[model samples]
Target: MAETDPKSVQDLTNVVQTLLQQMQDKFQTMSDQIIGRNILTEHSLNNDNAVLKRLKEHQKNPKRVKVHREVYLKRNMKSFTLKRFPQ
Candidate 1:
């Protein structure tokens, strides 16, 4: 086997260091983006859960207008009478 030159070995080491640093930086950027998206997704899921809870509560106790036919007739008559009188 041939002996390697010291200068060439140093140059090779420097190139490998530079490539490793670039890969580390790229990995850090990707990790930060993934973490950010996860946080946003978690926040959105929480909001959706809150809205679903409110909807379920509303369904459990819904506002219902129970009007008897006689009451409705009386109200209708009164309105008709007022409209006829124009006062």
Candidate 2:
């Protein structure tokens, strides 16, 4: 059995970290392009639907909707709203 030197181990760790960062950047770029293309296509399609077009336009230029009454939340409580935005 051979013992690994500390410098060699550190170099290997650095290489692995660099490779991981490169992979993450590539994946993020690809995902962004895909999402952008989908949004453009969807907006083009919804141009014909008057109601959908109106909603999209509103989202593009968001106006404040009426604010509802405030509700109290308990400590350590997590809340989330699931909304499907028109593409």
Candidate 3:
């Protein structure tokens, strides 16, 4: 086998460095895209806050249910109830 030359080794090193830099740039771009997609932007935050405020206002005046009395009469009661089974 022929012995490798210094100049050839240096060229290989330079090529490896260039490839690593390109990969780093690609990874950075992919990371930026992922972060951008997952994170909420300023406009989205404002819209979310507006929706939450509306929901809070609606919840402030919730409906009330008043149960007056329960009369246990034999004619009004049902004889059977359905049983639920878990899958």
What does the lDDT read for residue 69 in candidate 1? 46
TM-scores, all models, native as reference: 0.60, 0.47, 0.46
Each candidate's lDDT (Cα)? Answer: 0.81, 0.65, 0.64
| Model 3: lDDT of residue 79 | 28
What ordering of candidates by lDDT runs from best to worst?
A: 1, 2, 3
Candidate 2 residue pairs in backbone clash: none
User: Per-residue alpha-carbon lDDT of model 1 for 1-85, expressed as tens digits?
Assistant: 1443336878779878888999999999999999999999999999999989877876766552233446778999999999999
Evaluate candidate 2 by giving its C-alpha RMSD to the native, one decimal: 14.6
Best by lDDT: 1
For candidate 1, give the lDDT. Answer: 0.81
Cα deviation at 58, candidate 1, in Å, is: 1.6
Runs in model 1 with CA error above 4 Å? Answer: 1-7, 64-87
Whichever of 2 and 3 has more lDDT, that candidate is 2
Model 2, residue 2: what's the lDDT? 35
lDDT of 3 at 33: 89
Q: Which stretches of candidate 3 lie over 4 Å from their true place?
A: 1-7, 41-46, 59-87
